[model samples]
Target: MSRVADVKDEARSRLRWFAVHGVVRFFAERGIKIGDPQAKLIADPVTRANPGVVYQEIRDRGKIVKGRVAYLTVDHGLIFDLLRSDDYRTVVVGGNLPKPLRAIERRTRTAALHPLAPPSLLSVEPPSHTRYRKLVSSVFTARAVNAMRDNVQQVADTLLDELVAAGGGTVDIVSSYCAKLPVAVIGDILGVPEADRDKVLEFGELAAPSLDVGLTWSQFREVEQGLEGFDGWLATHIAGLRDNPGDDLMSQLIAASEDGVYLNDRELRATAGLVLAAGFETTVNLLGSGINLLMNNPDQLARLQDDPSLWGTAVDEMLRLESPVQMTARVAKGSVTLEGMDLEAGDLVVCVLAAGNRDPQVFDDADTFDVGRSNANKHLSFSGGRHYCLGAALARAESEVGLRTLFDRFPHLSSAGTGIKRDTRVLHGFRTLPVALGEPATVSA
Candidate 1:
């Protein structure tokens, strides 16, 4: 590209960064008021700025209230009941969105790909949800996760190896470390070949925005294109697995489906997309958020640097403090009363997963970031009941290994520049995190 083109591209990037920063700053200062009793999360800035306060306000009003969609917040007991209750159904796959929005999604062609692009597991209710969930549960069991510890450690080391070698005196942890590790591990788990890593990584990002219900038409077009690429590759890959079976999860899925008791070809492909995308997206946020929290809190960073044993609990604390998935949607399966609020069948209910994690009734000093907190393990970073994150064990292993190995290597790591926040509401984390390793120590003469 010519210098003129390069300059234009750079200019655009700066403008976008400033625009996002401005909106964030605006919400942070002015604060948001949900005058509409039935609030809907229509934009990213409000939730991104301070969802905790918003949730608290909603929760204070009663157990549930009207909005664009009804919201359940702050009350862990109510939220848990809703999450685990068969009375509620998933928003998208369960056919809960308003007719106009659902029609719009279908017209965009993006909705058609939802089952496979995000997979049915995260969005569908039982019978189908149960079958899909059971198919992959064995692969992520406690014993299975324990077995991957060595591989997780090795991947962490390799990524950190690249970071220290190329970082000189600084690195962007999001791109250089946190983002790369989870994708690589997912690739390994799914049996993605080394030669296809670049394509897998590229498609992973393009396909991710489809998971959010707040996407615009243009965003839907982009997501459609991404799903086309991902689904095409997945279909062909499943075909290959059939021709030549392997020990990976993909092959297992294929064999299970052949019995006619599990998912068919399309469902199998959808399940694969869901696992890979879900695995990569959430785990990346957990690592990035954890590291960012530690950097901002030197005392906490020092504690971890002093003793690596605390790394496990520290990851939990991070999940509690900065949940990756902020809220999830559920629709009333049938008319029912929650916290004394009556709802008709098909009413939408949004569960504030992160807010519940910080509920004062369940957690002591709920607003404080304390890594040593005894009950950090009780966080709802992973949803509860039937839809609980199937990959919880694997995520914990990957994050614990990644964060532990990182701080151990760069004890002097500190922020070198401003970090940019992602422009999404449902998932939150940095787009980039610049840090300096304090110029590697000079050896004494």
Candidate 2:
């Protein structure tokens, strides 16, 4: 064929691929049938806000409604069943990597895996998942997180001081406070050097989208580059810790690997990467969302300010009301029945965690944010079953201390600027929250 003819053929092929993968795949992920007129509703922020409406519609249609590309479940009971059952599984990457990314991996032959790289906890099933979970589960237990309370508090205090210093008590809380606290706490937990904490924050945010399925080609490249940079740095640090073990979680995990806990070098890199990356991003979103919730809901904010003891429950309520992780997907492994819907092997099951948290059948005044709600812990913000968040305790501790400190330090805090919401489909939170730390200036005498 002539060169011009070959180029024209390649252009046609590119168009065909985008039509199939880009347009079709995006709609399928949202649980819309190809001919559905209601597809536009999914793109609307007002409609998206109450995922319960879509969830209930899907539930009403069937236990599982098969979209063009995947099956979806929003029924609270079905979601829990799917999460806990071995019948369903997770495919973290889902073939989203661009050709160039795959080519780069083949050429580089690096031992380092992206933090969201497959076979890690977020992607694999047991016995691999079981083995990986066992390696660090003990250290992430409630007891371990409790032991770090003073450190967490100290980090929150230090960040608050910085917040007060910046913008003269008028600050963007997401940057000046929420964004910093989690990384500092997780950094301290993983024994990251003080000098490197800022990089961890930078990399954590950049690499977080690796957890989602909707990456554009450009996004895939950025995610890959960020993961490579962070993972490369992490690999060197991990090697040093392996040789000179310390009291930090990284050293402990490395020591365990040496003592025959059975983690390969690649697994070691992915594990540490996952811990710092996942721990940092989710907790940051949690704190940011929690602050957004309280800022908008003055009554609940007042309740926490008055009692102080309600901070724990208040955090849970925030998680329930504005879950950091709005949705996650699973794949069915075999023929099975779910709430009257039958599924064959290879069916994708998208679980709407945020929707389930708002199911009226589960909680009283499910839509309302009640800090004193007794059942707030039942929220699946940390997920459920074998795939539950490994750092749940640490996330809770960080947010509790962070919130308690912020409110205590600035009881008169109020919104000073329009908050900016993050434009993301998977992780939900504000990108910026501007607040005044003290009472508004009174008239001069």
Candidate 3:
């Protein structure tokens, strides 16, 4: 923690980052020059924002298109199979690098508990994955989520009330409502104090890009700082919970044990941190994308207005049309044949979930966004199998109630400007969504 130690740690982190991603950037840039669609997908911001063309190109190439770095798949069925299969494992940072680079990574591994690191459900496979998942699964079960619905609605209503009180000018919905609502819910669930909710949001924003690949040194440093800060704060918070438990999920997790084996300090921190951050990040994207989609497609909005029951399906449709988490990768555990394509051990497969959601074979008129689309719920947006999003139910509940309440309150909301998109390939959503709240709907007397 001294200045000297800090400098050393920073140097080590930089070395590890370069070992893992610097070569990736170098090849990605070279591949981009050669017009490699996969490289462009990895390196280009424009391609990340509008990936359909590259997805189509990948699909056209084959079921599994080899890229400069890894193989790409946009096929819905193959993605589904790969996600569910035990033959594939989650890709851990520094895991697939060459021996020398991995040696550099091992020596320089930082002490920060990253959301994508082991002990976090995102990074581990079964046995460990099963254990970690089991401890938290009960809290997110359908019954538990349904019990939280009224609270979610109240939170949505409170946020909308604050938005209404901001006069009638343009405001960034991402900050005011979309981001705040889910963060508040997740914060309360994690026993995060109201005063520190903003700090949690700040940490989340800084660390969001940790899910991505090929980050520049500055980006990597920022992400590590965020992770380090969150780790320190979470340790103190967990100690407080241990001393005096509350009704929050984190408190429940603190006391909960499995077969007389309780979670250690590191495991506890990783689980609590992942839940708190992942709890709201994607939902924030889902809400932002939902609002944008509704504004752009008035017919879909009109349909929802006519039949409020369609709100549930409307959220699913939004997730399908504009998936919050764009892509996820899996490394083949061993020799495997997927859809007649051979994959050896450690072969990386980047599943384009957004593209798979738009696969024509899976959904008729896949590009179209229809709230009433009967098969909207079948999309790969939540992913599949064990690594599927733990907060999917809560996200759905929050998005359904949040979007419904927003539009119901401001029935004539309109865009103020083009707005800013979050600059990350893995997570897709608005960073700032400026919208004009036309007028408050008349409430029943």
Candidate 4:
């Protein structure tokens, strides 16, 4: 059997184990308890013989319940009736976002700090947290984002120009394009220095697999040191902006603070950091998964090429199917009831956005990719309620521009046989994807 088949076989077997065990009832069976936060997970199994599986552990009532976040190659969703169970309570959403965002929540819970990081950004107070989101929405208005079309086009065009000049023989599209373009655009918007762009992108990949499951103290310390470096870098950048104003978002935010109608220095830095992470990293996964999807389904690719506007709408569908932000965490401030489980305050919950995006009941043909479908936005890829992504428009704009330019230039583009599967540590994406440039076109570099 092929290697891909082996991976698929393993996944199928794991899923089968969950089928007989019952989705929500497998955590205790797996022997995971207070050593970690308490939550229930319905995950993708290694085989089809079983349908549900226990992959994540729960320790306390404060944690949230996000069953399983799936991959595009997987069945795409896992569901459980936690709400209908006798045990239901509010718990922390124990994904990477909460832990990271919790460290500093002034202005960044809405932004992605790392592409693979998930332990931060949990909201203890949904109402206030939702309101905080509204304030950001006011800034990332449709008008503000629509204004970025020229910006997106500039970044996309410049990068492709460089790509074409490098002689277009065989390029690692992710390294050459997908991974860098969004970061370039967002970093510039936030005024991040040119010298640091590559390193920042690398940091986003550090936690692709989620928090250290069995890290020694030293390993965890290394991770913290890495985060400290990132934070320190941002602090210096903000200080520079404070000293000399520019036309970038950082300067604009500084001016807003002077007007007494905006974020403070700390808040400004957090917001800027959020913008960098959101604008670049999540889209990395989107573009990677998207290209793979297209290559896997040429029919879909042809359909998209026949109508480029479909790229905009299709982007949403892609986000749903292969959600880049995979999971988000939320912590409960006080004790609450859910799924009949009596829970206490400070419980952790890891809401699997990717899994929810593929819920069978929520989508028609949930496992299949159908860009023509009208229900794409129903996906929790951007999540729902208060914490919707502030950069959703910007992310879409980056993709629309990038994909459109790509198809326009290299309609015959295709992947090389294999790639560097983006290290599966913090994020699930491609760090390298070699593709054929195929037959130069009349397109201008």
Candidate 5:
């Protein structure tokens, strides 16, 4: 029986907890009585680009109302009912997604990578329809990814080799050391013909920012221009597959003549771009975030070195604490009441992974980085539902191998240049991480 005025005051005090619609949705669906009404702000064109992180108000009965619920803030996990409930039902998360994401159906957005596009490919969904999951899943399958490790190692090694060859001095790790490995590796796996890897990587980097419909024409144009070559390249490659299929993903999609839900040429091309971009983009962030944790928290790094077993747990802790991909937006089915806020059809919900992973109720010290923390892998970084990161295992393997090798090799490793800096919070990757490689700390093969 909380009155609207009281509810508004409480909601405002707790504003830090919610970043966007997640705050409103979380409270409304839980039946919390708050005067805060569902709304969005449109002060500038760019506001629409960051739908999840951005907020605004709607007029209710000619009175200014509540739309600035905190979705990105850490506290949303503490008070929001749906977010705090143990039931853990998956809700449709919308907003903060690219305009292309709008093309995906609501039901399949978080849980499955449908024949069509799904919401921000980062949501944690439980894919019950394993067939659809299976169709395009092989690209990230173990066998396929294992084929790329030596290649990844080569990429990692080559970057290091060049740095080490340059008298083993300080180097800009982001560009020279960390950034290129995953980009190059995924580029190879996606069958991005040798000729276009660089351009493909450029697109991958360009597209990693939070999808914003409010993107500047320049930003939108950047992707359009970058993708022009990418789409054409995929068309040519798939054509070759039609003439002669091979063991690669392009061939698999092409070879599925029947009983298999094959992607149309458009889906094939879009997914091709998405797969490469997602695979490399997330892993690159993982590497940056993990290495940053180790460098900043010396004790953890010491523990990792002392007991190599801790490496795996430390990486899990890293992912939990600083999820590479922050939050993803999902759309609702028809109309839904979330925490007392009545959402209409086509309304969007944003789920902040960083905030959820840090929910006070979920983890003992959600803020702290504890490599030894158990159940750390349960964090929503890879998500739980259907659309879980298909390449999670591969990403795990890559992180373990990459970080372990880097730290183990360079026992005396220390970064040069300024400490790592990252403007793009979406990917959470280091712009420049300068580190000197230690004496080949190859833990094992």
Candidate 6:
């Protein structure tokens, strides 16, 4: 009887996965065939790889262009306003979906917690979001991030040292340096054991595509499995932290209380898991993209070498050129008119943040990479308003220190081969950055 029940459960799980993701994929592919910009942007890999063209196409259409599925916007000012507007919400609810799809989604909902699902910071509204954000905001503040600079520097130096010891002919910098630096720092903050850090990275990589709109069965399966493993591991880790806590951020979170009401077990897992995964994923992309940008623009690299003070602005420039997070979505709370376009309740608006970062109206010479661009900081790479990236300071610090230390150590570092971009749509970054780590600079006597 137990064996039969196990088989029945597996069948139901597969059916739910199909109903939730496969159905969406089927329609998205049809939309792509018809040249729907929004559909292509979401479902087509080629379009995702070269999204600048589509971003411009949407911009040319209008500030608020209606798509077959959702409305699209690439205007910096408009996107900025919408993100901060109370008229919009993060998660898509019943109002946005067809009756059939909504019923399927409701039935398919499982116990698994998704980063983009409710209870996660990315999906909650004001009150819950306010409470969750407050709990973790202090640790990521400018002052707190500044305190972690020394530790970041130490991690960068150690990684470079290992590269030198390897005799330095060629190495995939993404795996060796760019990815490791931020992960080490975040791991220390989150109390993840060093031996298990690689597992965390694996789970994060597999689950990353969950942020996208549609997925194939295989992709959806991999993502669900990854989330399951992470959920189990996190539950155990939290239990251990409760038994014997440390000074890490995870420990602090465990001890934290709001109005004498601590977070419940499910809420704790959701919050902690988000911190652990988000802590390093985007920073890894920032570092990888920063390195690639500097390598491509030797003139800009020379400027950084001449004046080290420019590293800060240089990091901002990199963000402007290649934002780690490319886009986000919001749902209309009720009937509203924006830029003369009427949006009903539950309408979805896709904000191409990468395009907004490069809006000519807001940025001069937007396509060109300029390290000293005065208004580089104005870019919406970290997003805006209440949902802005909590770890912006840490990502910036890591990118600046990581890039400066790398170039300073290996002044002649050059690409060994063409870098491979990540196979993700929402998160833009390199999967493998192969580089020849030239001889290190000798210290003065």
Best by TM-score: 3
lDDT, model 3: 0.88
lDDT of 3 by residue, 293-377 (tens): 9999999899999999999999999999989999999999999887677889999999999999999998999999899999999
- Order of candidates by lDDT, top first? 3, 6, 2, 1, 4, 5
TM-score of each: 0.86, 0.85, 0.97, 0.72, 0.70, 0.96
lDDT of model 5, residue 86: 31
Question: Can you write out model 5's per-residue Cα lDDT over 342-405, one digit (the tens) per residue?
Answer: 6555455555566567665678876788889987876777744455677787677678878877
lDDT of each: 0.72, 0.73, 0.88, 0.58, 0.57, 0.85
Candidate 1 regions exceeding 4 Å error are 1-34, 37-40, 44-47, 100-112, 115-119, 257-260, 439-445
Between candidates 2 and 5, which one is better according to TM-score?
Answer: 2
Question: Superposing every Cα of model 1 onto the true structure, what RMSD results?
Answer: 7.0
Number of the top-ranking candidate, with lDDT as the measure = 3
lDDT of 1 by residue, 1-445 (tens): 6999878745543433223232333343332263542233444355457666567777778767666445555567778887788888776541554465445334433233564223478767777787778777755567866877888888988777666677557778888888888888888778888787778777766666655554554554466567778888888888888899888777777676423686778788878888887888889888888888888999988887777778889889999888888778777878898777788998878777788888888899998888888999988888888989888888888999988878777777888888887766667677788888664433234
Clashes of 5: 34
Cα lDDT of model 2 by residue, 1-445, tens digit: 6999878745643443343234534664464444331342334455455555666676577656766556666667778777888887876453333455444334433344744446577877888888888878856667788898898888887776665556456778888888888888888778899898888777766666665543455555566567778988888888878778778988877766423666877788878888887788788899888877788889998888788888899888888888888888777788987767787777777777887788777888888989999989888888889988888888888889888777777777888888887656678788889988884323234
Q: lDDT tens digits, residues 166-218, model 6?
A: 88879999999988898899988888899988998898888888787677778
In model 2, which runs have C-alpha deviations exceeding 4 angstroms? 1-53, 59-63, 95-112, 257-259, 439-445
Q: After superposition, how far is residue 422 of candidate 1 from its true place, in Å?
A: 1.4
Off by over 4 Å in 6: 1-6, 92-95, 443-445
Backbone clashes in candidate 4 total 83
- Candidate 2 accuracy as TM-score: 0.85
- Candidate 4 lDDT trough over 10 residues, lowest sum: 70-79
| Candidate 5 Cα lDDT to native | 0.57
Candidate 5: regions farther than 4 A off: 1-132, 146-151, 257-261, 419-425, 438-445
RMSD to native for every prediction? 7.0, 5.6, 1.4, 11.0, 11.9, 1.7
Candidate 2, overall lDDT? Answer: 0.73
> Which regions of candidate 4 are displaced past 4 Å?
1-138, 207-222, 258-262, 423-426
